[model samples]
Target: MNRSIDIFDTTLRDGTQGEKVAFSAEDKLRIARQLDAFGINYIEGGWPGSNPRDMEFFELAADASFEHARIVAFGSTCRAGASPEEDRNLRLLVEAGTSVVCIFGKSWLLHVEKALQITAGQNLEIIRDSVGFLKQHGKEVIYDAEHFFDGYKSDPEYALSTLKAAEEAGADTVVLCDTNGGTLPHEISEIVAEVHKRVDIPVGIHAHNDCELGVANAMAAVRSGCTHVQGTVNGYGERCGNTNLCSLIPNLQLKQDYECIPDEKLEELTALSRFVSELANLNPDIRQPYVGRSAFAHKGGIHVSAVMKNEDTYEHVPPSRVGNSRRVLVSDLSGRSNISYKAEQLGIKLDKYGDNVSEIVQKLKELENKGYQFEAAEASFELLVKRMTGVWEEFFKLEGFRIIVEKNVSGSSRTEATLRIKVNDQAEHCAAEGNGPVHALDKALRKALHKFYPEISNMHLNDYKVRVLNEKDGTGADVRVLIDSAEHGKSWGTVGVSHNIIDASWQALTDSFGYYLAQKQKSIQQKEVI
Candidate 1:
């Protein structure tokens, strides 16, 4: 068997099935170029003849050139009792003009009888004719045996015959799919072993994550001699999701000694994952396996100390290997090493054993114990450290603020905010109204600050999320607010905690403005020196 596994990405096809996941033809084309740039083996454009966007994408991709990844057009086999030459779906696959085509056919006897209302033998004939038609047209056909595992368990003989029909019709590879995503990894290994014994064609695995076993089962298939793997970029698909190629590529190359994607391309995994999620208009799940933001976050004091001495003490692999960096999360649980690490990143030199490090650690612990979380709000954490170090300078000071919520004529609540602040010891008061209190505060604060610092007008508040800490207190619980802020083209997250929602949002909003101004000033100073 070939040691090199082929990575087949169906993000444009299957990934679009995910709820809230939609992509236009241009979006699909942009993603295809990125996948090819990263050296994916096969990029499944979409299922042609199903949607206009997919058909347009296939038409546009006909003239596009890919350096490493082959653009594959996907469709199902000819309909039951229909001739291959007359099947519209099969025709779309060939009209796509791609060198390779993937055609899925009924493997489960239940699906064949109930869904297609056809006899098992008739299903096999369509599989045979579909593969034969594509091959005769000079297209390399990959047969997807959909629901193969469930089919084998129900009727092993009937399932094997479907694959045999495709192989006889010149299909080069037969991909086994856990269509219902209910089979276990051990079951996948057993079924794949059985299939390899019955068919001479190479095997592949396409799995879903309903049981959270997509990656595990795909790995099991590889161990059982399958040479091709199918998945999406960030595990985007229907139900639970598809196998995450961001996690799969590293497992095959770094851990399993299999050459799947190139090393340099593998390093771009983190960026690629973020790009896809960004295009989907969804926030990245920072806890995802290899490419997540919090994948290597350290919170325990002992763990931080051990990691500083030797990263292997806590890390499974060098995070930089996949373009992700280790993060030292400072909280009430952190130690001196955590403080030292964060300070280093901030470009603030602190002696590892100095009083400054000890003081900062103790202060952080005290504040965190009082409900100040710095992990998600590094900007506020930096400001705290600067204050403790006595190097902090205030750009502005809040005199006071007020917000009023009243019913409008339409019975909807309207929020009005008044902000008073002093910059250079000069007082400025501003007022604004919004649909909500937080929005009112955001507008009022920026209005007051923009007078002193016009550059702050470039800052935009992106996302605001709130979590109640003491739910036992019910409506009186303390709330934690996390704000994602963007300036120019860069973005960062900051956090705040308070009993009042307005107070929590105000603190986070202030920290966001503070961070934005500080970064802007640093850039200007750097340019002057340059």
Candidate 2:
């Protein structure tokens, strides 16, 4: 019989140790509910004794009910020369109101001698007493043997003695930690197997990613009879990181035939990964395995062609299995297959047998050579196709535009823009002041077009990026601008390139407005047909 693996997530605890990772009390509570809904066995909330924020999280979590996961309080073993009852850290663990308590004890003699300034015997007593204290309080205890692998390598008898102490003290699980994260996969497999032979209780693994081997080491431990695995989402932790449950879960359930989460909940992997990244205010790693945006994205001409015929030709697994979709990118290297696929995805009609496909490919290459990247600026690509095929209708024509900057003695500056445009043979002119030249220009253009197309108010620019294309030319170098626009819960990107920054911004800005108008028209037309 294949036994299930227990997933203990430390994203709220150890994950926060990573640089730039932080979560509020509400954020931690929200994440705990998400993890429970996704079928995580245990969620390590935070150390209640460490900070007010962690204590606030436990207080908030006490009122919130989890459907599946048990909230765990994490702390270290009692300090040397102190009993568990007198230890403030242990006292906080009980008062945190969590059903499970996890505490780490020193396994390395070097730490025992130098860090704690205690003998090896005293360190063992700390581990034994800490676990026994939590058990006596009617709590399930998970004893973490900090630096177990390093300790085992130096003193095998002493390391095993640490696990024996926790076991004798009634630890529910003894987790072997590669605390320094320097252990190899073979060593992990051998050491865990040796521990499993000596220990009667379930063995666990908590590997770090300092060597980028956290997932590999965890997998090796499982293969050697470890039933519990501890990790953080996206491999988030101090130094490099901890074992990435995002990568390890799918690998375990799909490749190793070991159950980590419910098979049906597996489809939520991608969204969960992205959700956590958003909460942590971190950009999602597009190239991350299993759930990243670029994990199933195809770019090459040959790759797209083959993928069209058979996704299995290029993709390792079906993207749908992980709640991610396959993306076909179009660029200078795009073939007819690339454009045709993109056209379908964007709901654009094209004749596959006609010359439009080849024409668009050539035009894409020419534009890209001029520093227009269509891969990320699909809105601009769509407009290009529509114009090339004579299917695009003009929204407005720009007659002229002017900008003025004024400065005062206090180092403050004011920018104003004036623009004129003709819509359906009617001319409109407007002026506007703004914090920046681009903002002033955008406002002036919108004011001029508002009467003709009031729906333009719904679209707003959210992100703007400028890249210098010809750095060799210095200030005279051509620059490309990419603008991200959002409307009615949807977003799109447009690109422009010119020697002048204002001109480039204008081009991208106009394309952003044009794409929104075109999409709105298409939606209205579709509704009429229906």
Candidate 3:
């Protein structure tokens, strides 16, 4: 029989330790629901007693009926010389109303002596008492033996004693932590094997990524018979990071045939990873395994052609299995298949025997030589295709626009924008004032467009990115702007470029509204047929 492995997600606890990443109570709740939906075995929320936000999170999350995951409150073991009943943090962990409790205790003698200023025996008592108290309270206790690998190396007896204390005290799982994240994979396997021999209860592995071996070490521990893997989604944490469950879950289930996360919710992996990143206000790592933006994006001609013939030739796994899609990028390295694939995605019909593809491929190469990157600006590429194929119809025409910005000595700025636009034979002039010239321009443009197209009111910019083309001095750099907009749960992107930043933003902003309008038109036509 294959033993089950517990996937403990620390996104709320360790993932929040990432620089400038903090989830509000609402953010934590949203992530919790999503994690539960993804079939994670354990969700380790942050230390409730640490801050008001986390405290409120536990209070609100207490009523949540997680379908697959057990909510866990994380904190340190009760302080030395303190009763578990009297310790406020331990009490807070209990009162948080989670079915599971994870408490970290000092495993290294150096930490017992220096950090806690307690004797090794006193530290062991803290671990034993805390686990025993929580277990008595009918909570499944998980003792995270902090710095277990380093401590075991420093003084194997003391570290092993810590596990023995927690085990004897009734910890359901004793997790060994490489707290400093400096352990190698070989060292992890050797130490975990020894600890497995010493402990009777289930053993867990929690490796950090300071040496960038967190995932490797965690896998090695599993191979050595660890039944639980602890990590944050997307490898988020302080310093380097913890082991990444995004990579670990798939590796365990698909590669090692371990039953970690449920097989059905595997498709939610991509969305949940991105949703957590959005809640944290951090950009998702595009290169992350399974769910990353570039995980299945093909750029080279040979790779693209082969992927078109058989995706398994270039991809490790099918993207749809993880709620992601493969992308064939158009670059100088792209072949005819890449152009065809991209064209089809843009809703353009092309004959496989057509000669227009050669023209499109050559144009893509010419644009790439001119510093126009379609990989990052796919909207621009789509517009280029429409113009080349004469399939695009003009929805509105730009007459003229100008913006003025003034900065005063009082550290205040003012902007005035004016625009003239024509819809068919009708012309409209609009002006708006804003905090910045770009904002003012956007307001004026939308105000004018809303007069002719009421659907423009439903569109809002989701994200905007600006990049400089040249870094050399004394030369004006070309600016690129990518704009994301959404309406009715459908999102589309548009790109713009110019020597002026404001101009580039205006172009992208205009395209954002135009894309929505175009999509609405397509939907209406489809509805008419139905």
Best by TM-score: 2
Q: Which pairs of residues have clashing backbones in candidate 3?
A: none
**Per-residue accuracy of model 2 over 1-530 as CA lDDT, tens digit each:** 26799999999999999999999999999999999999999999999999999999999999999989999999999988789889999999999999999999999998999989989999889899999999999999999999999999999999999999999999999999999999999999999989988999999999999888999999999999999999989989999999999999988988889999999999999989988998999989999999987899888999999999998999888998888899888888889888888888876778833888888899999999999998778899889888877778989899999999999999999999999989999999899999998999999989998887899998898899999999999999999999999986588999999999999999999999988888888889999999
In candidate 1, what are the lDDT values of residues 1-530, reduced to their tens digit? 13799999999999999989988898899999999999899999998889899989988888788899988999999988679999999998999889999999999989999999999889988999999999999998889999999999999999999999999999999999998899999999999999999999899999999999999999999999999999999999988899989898898888988988877777899999999998888889999988999999998989988999999999898999988989999998888888888888998888733698888888888878767788888889988887788767878889999999998789878799999999999999999998799999889988888867899888888788999988999999999999989876688888888999889898888888887888878889999999
User: Please, what are the lDDT tens digits per residue for candidate 3 over residues 121-226?
Assistant: 8888888889999999999999999989989999998899999999999999999999999999999989988988889999999999999898999999999989
- TM-score: which is higher, 2 or 3? 2
- Which pairs in model 1 have colliding backbones? none
Q: How close is candidate 2 to the true structure, as a TM-score?
A: 0.97
Candidate 3, residue 249: Cα displacement in angstroms equals 0.4
Candidate 1, overall lDDT? 0.90
Question: Cα lDDT for residue 365, model 2?
Answer: 93
| Candidate 2 Cα deviation (angstroms), residue 342 | 0.5
Clashing pairs in 2: none
- Which 10 consecutive residues of model 2 have the lowest summed lDDT? 345-354
Candidate 3 residue runs with Cα over 4 Å from true position: 402-418, 434-437, 473-475, 500-506
